[model samples]
Target: MVNQAEQIDVPCADAIMRLLERYGFDTIFSIPGVHTVDFYRTFPERGFRHVTPRHEQGAAFMAYGYAFATGRPACCMLITGPGLLNAGTGIAEAYSDSLPMLVLTASNQRAELGVGRGCLHETKSQHAVEQQIAGFSHLVLDTANVAEVLHRSISLFLTARPRPAIIEIPRDLLAAPTRVTLETASMFHPPAPAPEAAKMAADLVAGATRAIAILGGGCRRSADAVLELIERLGIIAVTTNAGKGVVPEDHPLSLGSSLPFEPVRTLLEEADVVLAIGTELGETDLLYTCKPYQIPGKLIRIDIDPHQLTMNFHPSLAILSDAGLAAKEICKHLSASVSGADRADREKIVRDSRAKLVGEWSAEAPKHKAILDVLAGSLDRDALICADSTQLAYTGNHYYPSKTAGAWLFPNGYGTLGSAMPAAIGAKIGCPSRQVVAIVGDGSFLYTLEELATAVENRVGIPIVLWNNRSYGEIKDAMNAGGIPTIGVDLYTPDFVAVARGFGCQAILVESLSQFGAELGKALSRDVPTLLQIDADGPSFAELAN
Candidate 1:
């Protein structure tokens, strides 16, 4: 606990860094401005690795990618209103994905707050505006309250449902000395499942004739525990897009992220019991499907957020606990009571569901699958794919075979454009040893394409596979399907290879599917970014597949 009676000469800005250091922050993404420079006074001595993004949006997205890749929050320093507002979309994306981030931004001087006196870089209410997207947005009125407010914000990121915590510091207080005693960082454990709840869930699983498991993003850290339980019970498993790679796609009982597919949805309705872990079972998870998501049988849901237990689909039994802890508890109670005699039957079910999903694919799916096949064969087993909301990525969402958890990064919830390139750069910085690739559409690629300069400046080696379809293909298709005229879907795209070279990155125009593997190989060897543009008109993936 902090004692207000004790005083110190340390500036509030420096105090923040001191506490963040104790909290284990090693990297910061920001663009320094006059209002925020006070926080940088002893930046070099503090030894925090700083990354400067071209735009504030990139800063937030970079932090998001860092957290998503490493499963830990990263810090972002922003200027007053515009900087924070520009980063709003990225922050919202993080919140939607349930990723943790610490956002520190300068607000107007205490005297000018909400005055509408036309102060420079001022907003009417930064706090209220940010509260819509962030988990909580706090404005510090007194320097004495800074430490306690920070502790409260950070605790949520660590011990509860993870989301962005916005701390708005008044510029005038940045250099002010505070007497508040800083508290040493303390760790808090996530809540575990109740003994009764665990036993009830285990009993349901043990008694089911046909049971299945659905994993969500919340299971990223609990993959091993969840896999153990799934194997122990010999049950088929499917994953949402955000939960891809929770179980290796090659596993015999795995259904390869096919939750939204018609066949998988049908199978879920047929089961006698369904175990859902760490998922909202939201409509976004069932994207492109016409049928409303339903759970007709007994549904057992395990989640950290109590409110989420009944959000979309009601559960017969709900356990409010951390995904990993609940999974372990369920496994502990299950023991060796589950017989393995039915393991072969579960494997056959997975195979049949997958085959039916393939049979129901639209004409365009096979085209994207050919390209995905090439990518799957070329990348390393531990490689991470930072994907954008494009036609190719939309297909890969259900089809990509991820080898490990946290290996596939996509804007599934927020559905933002232009996150893949900057996110790939951030992922590389966070995990320098792992291979990172960005698969983006021509339209979305333009969103953060300028981040290529950052990649080159930092000497971060990453391959950006530009899927140039010459238009907003998905939207145009949607319009056509709805009997609407396509208007703004067609775009005049630039020569990406030439633009990339102008930015000092290695660039090439991939002429055919056969040439991509060689170019990607070369890209992986360089210490800077490589742009490989595959034109939609150049060759047909359907023809290649045939």
Candidate 2:
């Protein structure tokens, strides 16, 4: 069948912009360069908010965070070659978590595309690089296919698997007169499990002496459905970092996040049956070395990707299905059988495990609870927490409980540092009505410090919480644990509050825990960007190694 096409007498850039806006994307994160200037020029005419991050990589990460935060697909654009390569890391993170987004990158001139004559911004293959990092990648060489290609890219972004999609539109095409036929982007959902499979799984759960659900990133899309099923059945639940907040760590049935914590680890070890959903059960999330139970119990794995069924642990039941649909079906099959004194007894175990765990974690946390206490107390119920990858991030991951799913923008899959600031900026833009905050270590904060300017320019009012310890504390802890002397890990301290103020952000330094709550209150109340820097060691990195 021939793909859709139509002729429109306008620059390719103009057509692309209108098409994206029509497809429900009102905001974009981008960085412009010579090859991509044509598209950037159309931004004013398109009337969409274009957020320009300080770095191309940060732009891509911002886009990822936007989509992850709002449960909506987002878009990003960058210059060709070096710009595309810079976005590779962010694209990989989106791919790992199956975030829905579109990455539109400029390519060398269509005429000079493949010729090795050293054309400006040329690459070995821009499309090829993008293809490896996203769910789908297509090169639009013909101006006629501009709208069609972009629409299709959005469709791919929202559908099956729901990872990022890329469209590489060559620079020449942006100015070329083109045939443009706008098509509404379609959504293709992943297939649900067969009725028999759903029934079998439900029956197994109904009969289990002890059963628990292990949730992951993929389940975020179907959080409500999963939550309903678990709550209705009174089944205890636990989550990986990417899946944290699905059942609300505050919820009594939730064992909270699995890795880098003790309760979920001990509980998983003692379970007679495990029902894993929408996650690869990755090594880091597994906290494999932290525990001794490799295959804790009989497994029941459900995932959209068939390739992941047997990845880490083979399951007694592997159901190929959409997490939400399968969960709904299983709830139907086990409607009346999930309740009883026996189930209540098992649930008490989950509650007991959580209490024991929280009591322990909270004990140590109160010692350094200034940041934690202030954040927990001051956070808006609907706020989004975009956390960087560092010692403090891990502490927040374990200590800060999310009441809503998809509201926690964590750098889990790729574990990249410097993601918190830009991601928080994107989260704020994606859901302007909801508050967004960034929590980062000083080392990671500097990696994307330029974005403080991005936040200032865009008027994004995210409160950034900086843990200034003057060292890569996690790395230093690793050295100490490994019996090596810590060196080259210390960072030269800076006047962070002064720096933030210079960037037009409201800024303050918390010299002691006594000053913590009020400073955070000030930052959160500001309508413009703000920063709170605390000189501290968060949760003791060594505890996480356990």
Candidate 3:
């Protein structure tokens, strides 16, 4: 017979550890500080493997990368004040992108509140920082309510449209003895099906002449449903940059990414009906301009978050539901409602668009011809490519198409400049055998360049392709659109080849299309990690956009 007393007598921290273990979190990444002493001490005792990061920001990014690769949220602990503050950049990235994360921090004791008795790692306002993040909905500030808060917060973190949640542990409470409960209800809640809305969506699709489907990151969680919806409706589907791999780009219906492409912009404006699945269609996706093509035609927007349903452009029908379940329900009704004429027209459009894009790539100019060619030839079906927030992201979306599912990750929601390097590191670690590449601009590369040390030390040898434009190209593009002189946008960069070598990685520099193939091949063949710095013509966006 099992002893009931033995099962219920776990320590508070031990109980928390068991909860994490139940959730399949075996690794905890953090930078130790005075406030988090208990966490550091207890984490090891509770059988959690800890990774001590060189910097708090690096630790958070590492955790973010781990979550991205594993499709599971990772926990990060930071001390009060500076520790938490240092992690702000990466936290903002997770917040913007709806990445699942549990940010644990030590808080000043209640007894020391405003007494002017100096406290270590004290902050006047810690919660103030949490609110600054765009999608930080779940937070826990009281340690007395740790189990209750953990139960609720963990549920929210794993629920649909996952985002980062902050759990502040009081300094005194870490040592306080209390009864630890091991019982935790399952936090996973699948998005419920919306049969009625799906039927309505089907009817709307049946009536359209020219139709397009815009898939978002939320929809990517249900790639099968997205693919089924596409196959049934036979619509020309284009994903937002973040939603790139929801449907394979090689599919006839897949119109690649809709990130600031003039052709896509024109198509969206002319379409009769647009089905937006699980995407908020943020300002960045729309090139920060939503004048005429915001909602091109009859807009049918389905999202789990109700706040995302409203439109700067008009939305005809708004359905608030889970993306996957909604797509599944819509697929059920699509077969009967979709007519032969609609299917024929959609197929014809996709075929024509594919031919046009292919022809353009074949006849590309001296500048873009090389980068595109290398990407086209080297990118494997199973390879995962991560792009930073730069013109490189737009180019990758336009040119590179993944063969398998979850083969591409980008910093879309947060649009953080330095995300690709660390994210690529995480993705490589997540799938060590598969090829993982970080495509970054000079400015973005500089943001977390120090992470190269992390990569070298950890023996994570992923290829990094530097688009050496020597300028903040995205800002320059934005400035040109606004008719402003490019000030504070231009940048000076070091020789990435030398930088890569200094970090103990093989380095190559390619100036023309001719050198691309050789350099890329060499980089991939190397046993150790390599960096291929392509000093392509400045401002490729202007040429590519045209």
- For each candidate, the alpha-carbon lDDT, in order, equals 0.87, 0.78, 0.71
All candidates' TM-scores?
A: 0.97, 0.91, 0.87
Better of 1 and 3 by TM-score: 1
Error of 3 at 62 (Å): 2.4
Question: On a 0 to 1 TM-score scale, where does candidate 2 land against the true structure?
Answer: 0.91
Better of 1 and 2 by TM-score: 1
Candidate 1 Cα misplacement greater than 4 A, ranges:
1-8, 180-184, 539-546
Put down candidate 2 lDDT per residue, 1-546, tens digits, no spaces.
234555357788888887888678888888878888888666787788888888888888889889888888888888889888987888888888788878888888877777878987789777878878888888987887776677677656554677888888888778888756654445556688888888888878777777788899889989999998887667789888888888998887887774545666666677778889998888667432245335467888888888889987889999888889989988878858456786678668876776676543423254334456567777776678888876666666766778788877777777788888888888888788887889888899888898888888887888888877789887787798899989999889788889889989998766555466677667776767888776664343333122
User: Cα miss at 530, model 3 (Å)?
Assistant: 1.9
Task: Single out the weakest 10-residue window by summed lDDT for candidate 2.
Answer: 537-546
What tens-digit string does per-residue lDDT give for candidate 3 at 1-546?
Answer: 112232354444555666677667777777777767766556655677666666778777777877776777878878877888888888888877777888877777767644556788777777677668624533333434666666666677656567777877667666665455444346467556567877888899866778888887777667887788888777888887668778888886788764455566667888889998877787767552332355558999887777788855558888877787888787777656456777777777877766665322212233443465567677677677777876656556656676455667777666777878877776666567777778888899898888887778767777788877788876787798899999998888898888888989888775545455677767665545678776655433344323
Which candidate has the highest TM-score of all? 1
Clash number for candidate 1: 0
Backbone clashes in model 2, listed as residue pairs: 7-179, 8-179, 8-180
User: 167 in model 3: Cα distance from truth in Å?
Assistant: 0.9
Global lDDT for candidate 1? 0.87
